[model samples]
Target: MTDATLTQTGREPRSAGALIGRRLLRWGLYALLCLFALYYLLPLFVMLTTSLKSLEEIRTGSLVALPREVTFDAWGKAWSGACTGIQCEGLRPFFWNSVMMAVPGVLLSTLIGALNGYIFAQWRFRGANLFFAFLLFGCFIPFQVVLLPMARMLGIFGLAGTIPGLIFVHTIYGLGFTTLFFRNYYVTIPHELVRAAKIDGAGFFRIFWSIFLPLSLPIAVVTIIWQFTQIWNDFLFGVSFSSAGSQPITVALNNIVNSTTGVKEYNVDMAAAIIAGLPTLFVYIVAGKYFIRGLTAGSVKG
Candidate 1:
């Protein structure tokens, strides 16, 4: 009885020690996570503060300070009265153009990506893996490397300096990432779902639309938000693909912020930057739940 009791006592202390160690580990993880959160949020805080400040105050005070005179004039200027060219058209036109470009680009690209991903995930044809391998390869190539060829191709196709051209460009670029995202996601789904659908005489398009699409809500949100943000905030592609009248907000913002002879208005530039970012920001905020859901669904399922 004494030996048995001693053994019981030894196990109890070991279990208690492990509990304490786990608590310490959890606390350490939370502390590190808090630090990382602060690191990421600092830049956004600075941007917000700077946007509120007047031009003179911004130059005088530290970037971290609250504006002494908070004014919406910068936002007003950014929205309707600031000059980008000889015209004082503000960011409104470019903003509209960006919306037009992003909406169609996101929709088309996400649709194509979902279709491609579903096929890759469900169907196993000869050379399908090889084709997907090529798609993955496309993702690694830099946009800049393809710019010249893309430009020449657009010019040849009579799509140069047009909205459709920009949309097409964004869609093509988006295909790699979107396809990969959906493909990875669809792989985690049970094969029995597809098999059952097939047994009921569901064809590819019918199964995809009726069954697979409904289950794809989480990833669809992610794809839309990603493609929307990328196309909306794109500068290099906008500048390269379109002329002055056809350019997106980023190009206009660049022109506004980088005039060779004009006096730079850092405050307005900050405001314009915020405005340019707002749509994507709004997209993320609205779709935040689905994004989290999508990521969790992938991880938890795997």
Candidate 2:
């Protein structure tokens, strides 16, 4: 018999009936996905509509309709001049401060985490596994437990109550989680690659910089997204480590939304929340594929 006939007879290639069933199953999956998408997106739709409404319209409580007189005033107020407190200014500065904090914190934490992961994966030095066990334990420990000690350490280094202080705090806090993520990922990679690099006389830093980092795109994207979200959205740490001027956008958003004596502008508050979340949203949308792909590659290979 011909190879083609043999192959066809062996598996009896999927029948038309089977193909129809698969098509129906795919359509059902699509329908289910649409429902989930709608459920998750409903809140954003509400927020966008609410942000466009005036206080009068909001008080009238039309949660669904567009305002009769659409206005960009809320957007303007959110961007140019609005009061978080005595200062009636837009969230521009706080937004910028958050950008500043998140960028450096993301970069440093990813670098450290990648290095630690590489060392743990390749070196096999004495006490290395024990050190990693301690680091993993650190991930479950609550930040609140270390708050006082972290504050004191910052003071000792003269970094407390400053932007640098907040950056340092975020980096330190992010280290454990990022390290865990990268370490787990690196463990999935083949040690043969590192061994080959070493056979080529590549030293530790050279191997990491030239070989490992280039291959670590997925894990790096995951690390950046995770750390950026954590540091950017962090209110408690920002409040603790930063004073009034150096405070991040989260603190500003809080002060805007929560006030003792003033009526809250829910529209502007929602706008501010959206604004504060924009970077993380953008990062996730942009890098999300790599993030998922990285996790998939790491998990399935081992």
Best candidate according to lDDT: 1
Off by over 4 Å in 1: 1-38, 260-262, 299-302
Off by over 4 Å in 2: 1-38, 260-263, 299-302
Q: Which 10-residue window of candidate 2 scores lowest in summed lDDT?
A: 1-10
What lDDT is reached at residue 194 by model 2? 83
For each candidate in the order shown, give its overall lDDT on alpha carbons: 0.86, 0.82
TM-scores for every candidate against the unseen true structure: 0.85, 0.85
lDDT by residue (tens digit), candidate 2, 213-294: 8778888888898899899889888888887788899898887777525566778877877888888999999999988887
